[model samples]
Target: MYKILIVEDDNTIAEEVGRYLMKWGYEVEAVTDFGDVLGHFGRFLPQLVLMDIGLPFYNGYYWCGEIRKVSQVPVIFVSSASDNMNIVMAVNMGGDDFITKPFDLEVMAAKVQAILRRTYSFSAPTSLMEYKGMILNLSDMTLVCRDEKIELSKNEYRILQTLFENTGKTVTREAIMKRLWDEECFVDDNTLTVNINRLRKKLEGLGVEELIVTKKGIGYRLGEL
Candidate 1:
């Protein structure tokens, strides 16, 4: 099923849209915390976003731009402000379509299905892993945190991917080494240490400090910053 993220702050409208989408066999989530729109977007990894123009903290345009940074997912603006200026701004900010408020559920669903067919028919959905506010784009091997995009090396990407897959749990060095070995990139203890240190530095640079915690005898685990 295609997933949709609704970024509308109005509870009644959001609920109505969510219910309508769910009834049509589409997975839907309505955003509640407007301050962390991108954070929710990262975590949800929805195939398409339904955004409203007048939001609580940042407007829909800002969130749409942020989504464009890490994803090419289709975004349709749903707002009462259907003026030409707002519509132009929405498209300029990377919106795929705009739906005026008080819209018919059937019309909205049809537009959504059309966009999904056009977007996915030509490309597979990108895989994303998100923890905290950091989003890892598996297709591109890059991480986005606090609006900062960080490119990851092969080893760094593997280490982070392993940790994320087993969040809140310790992963033994032997297990990590085995995973790397399975990928045909054998690394000694020293090399692993270097990679860990480098990854830590990169994470710190993105304001994520002490995320990878080292458990002396066992291995490393993701820690709260």
Candidate 2:
């Protein structure tokens, strides 16, 4: 099930939205501390976020930008601020969609489903891969470190993709070779090594030094920030 983060101050609305979302088979958590919206966000790490405009400490747009700094998870604004200016600002602030408040729960659910499908039901990245401050765009196969964009060569990207996909656990070299070879790329074991070295250099240049580490006998992994 996809996790969802709800950033609304109204306790009634939070319970109401959380209830329906749970009924629809989504794991949801509503924000409790407006001052620490980003903190709760990192802990929840929801696939979709429902944010309200007028909030306690920092507004929804502030929290949205904070989340965007590390992730590209789909965020939809749900607020009473239905004015065109607010909607435009929402989009500019990295909100994927805007749902004006006093909305039909059914319609809200429909839009949520559509956005989830567009982001995950297809051959997308499944979702963006995030490490410390970098977001790896699996859709376009690009690594984003801060404001810098680093493009990867075919082999380099594939190698990094494999390691990050299996971030915590180590991916064996044999498996890496098989995957690369399966892509119609020839590899004689040492080929993977060459690609990894090059990818590491690129990552180090982007401040993600030693982003991919070898396990001597096992393979490689993207362990830390």
Candidate 3:
């Protein structure tokens, strides 16, 4: 299912839109904290965003620009200001479409579906795992955080993928070795340690410190951020 983030200040409108989208099989999150819109956006990693132009705090245009710096996810402006200037500004600021207020929920759903189909149909679905604002794009083997992208080595990517798949749980060294062997890596205990250290350094370079926690006597697991 496609995930959507709704950035509207009006509680009633946000709830109505959220409910309508949910009924149509879309996973939706309505923004409640205006101060940290980008934080929520990064955490949710939604495929599309529904933003109201007039928002509390920094307004939708500012948040949309911030999102564009990290992702090319489709953003549709849903607002009461439907004037040509506002529409133009929305598009100029990276909005994909504009929806006037008082829109029909059915029409809105159809437009959302159409946009989603057009935006994602041509591209392979990207699988993502996120923790503490860090997002791992499994399809691209890239990590994104705070507008920074980090390329991962084969072993590093595999190790992180394993830990993310088993979030908040311990993964044994034996199991990791088995997976690496299956991938034809053929790493020994020492080699695994080297890889883990390298991965930790790379994560630290991206401002994530001590992400991989060693579970002495057991194995390794990701530390909760």
Candidate 4:
């Protein structure tokens, strides 16, 4: 299911929109605390965000810029400020679309659907996967932790992608090899060992030790931090 975040302050509007979106089978979260919008965002990691222009603590544009610094998740502005300047600013602030206040909920829902299709239907790489405070940016093939961007080679990316996809499960060596085969890479037992060692060292450098635990002749599993 695609998760959505709503950053509007008005109680009635937030609850109403949340109910409408929930009825459509979308997992929705409406922001209540205005002080830590970004913190909420990182935890929810919503695929899309519905923002309001006139928020309590900071405006939608400010929060949008903050989100852009870390993620490219699509943001659609739903606001009462329908002026041209505000609309242009919304787009300039990394908003995907804009909807003025007192708008039809059906049209809003349709816009949400259209934006989701355009962003995800083509399998766009602008998405993030987070595990144990480690965020993998598929778009850039980089792992971000504590503001550090660790670049991953093609082989490293493939291995980590496999592990992240399975999360808590133990991924067999043969399974990882199959993923590498799909990339047309020649990976043998020794080659997989070397790549695993390198990736582990990189993770350790970021103070994330024991993230990948070997299963003793079985395979590897993603362990707790």
Candidate that would win on lDDT: 1
Better model by lDDT, 1 or 3? 1
Per-residue lDDT of 129-220 in model 2, one digit per residue for the tens? 66655666566677767456777787776777787678688999988887777766565887788888888888788777767877999988
Decide which is better by lDDT, 1 or 4.
Answer: 1
Question: What is the RMSD of candidate 2?
Answer: 4.6
Candidate 2 segments whose C-alpha is farther than 4 A from its true place: 1-3, 9-12, 30-47, 54-59, 62-74, 92-97, 100-127, 130-134, 147-149, 182-190
The candidate maximizing TM-score is: 1
List the pairs of residues colliding in candidate 3: none
TM-score of 1: 0.95
> In model 2, which range of ten residues has the least summed lDDT?
123-132
| 1 or 3, greater by TM-score | 1
Cα lDDT tens digits for candidate 3, 115-206: 89999999854567777767777777888776678899988989999998888999999998887667655556898899999999998888
Off by over 4 Å in 1: 182-186
Tell me the lDDT of model 4 at 155.
79
Q: List the residue pairs that clash in candidate 2.
A: none
Q: What are the RMSD figures for all models against the true structure?
A: 1.4, 4.6, 2.8, 4.3
After superposing candidate 4, which stretches have Cα over 4 Å from the reference? Answer: 1-3, 9-11, 23-27, 31-47, 53-73, 79-89, 100-107, 110-128, 137-140, 182-188, 204-207
Error of 2 at 187 (Å): 3.6
All candidates' lDDT scores? Answer: 0.91, 0.81, 0.87, 0.87
